[model samples]
Target: MLGIAAAVLFFIAFLINAADITTNDVFSSVNVMLIGLGLLALHVAGIGHGRRTGRR
Candidate 1:
């Protein structure tokens, strides 16, 4: 699922940030984290919309 993938990405990012594994800050930046959370929100919204419309 997208939410699971996003959570994995977030964990990876956290590890990368904590371990100083990446020289590029962009890879472990808050922007990337926010993007993952945005994906989760989008997924939830899609489910809500689907249920409301009764499309399945």
Candidate 2:
């Protein structure tokens, strides 16, 4: 569940970045990239938690 949430959040960030790039908003693009990276990290942490618990 947490992994799925993180994936969705990252996807939203991707969309935001794409929109910003299309509009030539460099600052917003960078911000979106940072947000996406944070979400990716969360996703990885969730995966680690599952691994530690021996759950698929």
Candidate 3:
């Protein structure tokens, strides 16, 4: 669930940044990168939990 939430957030960030890329805002790009990093962290955490619980 957390991973899924993170994925959604990352997608939203991408969409927002892509829409405003024409303006070339550095802050927006940074925010998107941060969102992507957060998503990665959530995915890693989910994988770790699955491995520890030995469940599908």
Candidate 4:
């Protein structure tokens, strides 16, 4: 869920920045993408842990 949220945030941010007609802030998009990827990594780690412990 958190990963999904992050991805959504990144997508929205990308759309907003892309649609703007002013100076492009590369940091914003990069930050959002990083955050999304971080969340995804966390989720994957959690899943791996759960599987290793045999927890459903």
Best by lDDT: 1
In model 3, which range of ten residues has the least summed lDDT?
45-54
Candidate 2, 23: how far from true, in Å?
12
lDDT by residue for model 3 (1-56), tens: 55766677677677777786553565575676677677678777664344365568
Stretches of model 3 off by over 4 angstroms after superposition: 21-29, 47-56
Q: Which numbered prediction scores highest in TM-score against the true structure? A: 1
Supply candidate 4's per-residue lDDT for 56: 80
Compose the digit string of candidate 4's lDDT tens values, residues 1-56. 66577679678668757876343566566666777788778877674243355568
TM per prediction: 0.61, 0.41, 0.46, 0.54
Residue runs of model 1 more than 4 Å from their true location after superposition: 47-56
**RMSD (Å) per prediction:** 3.7, 5.4, 5.0, 4.5
Where in model 4 is the C-alpha error above 4 Å? 20-27, 47-56
**Once all C-alphas are superposed, what RMSD does model 1 give against the true structure?**
3.7
Answer with 2 or 4, whichever has the higher TM-score: 4
lDDT of 2 by residue, 4-53 (tens): 55566567667766665454454464565566567668767664355365
Order the candidates by TM-score, highest first. 1, 4, 3, 2
| Pairs with backbone N, CA or C atoms under 3 Å apart (clashes), candidate 2 | none
Give the C-alpha miss distance for residue 24 in model 3, angstroms: 14
Ranking by lDDT: 1, 4, 3, 2
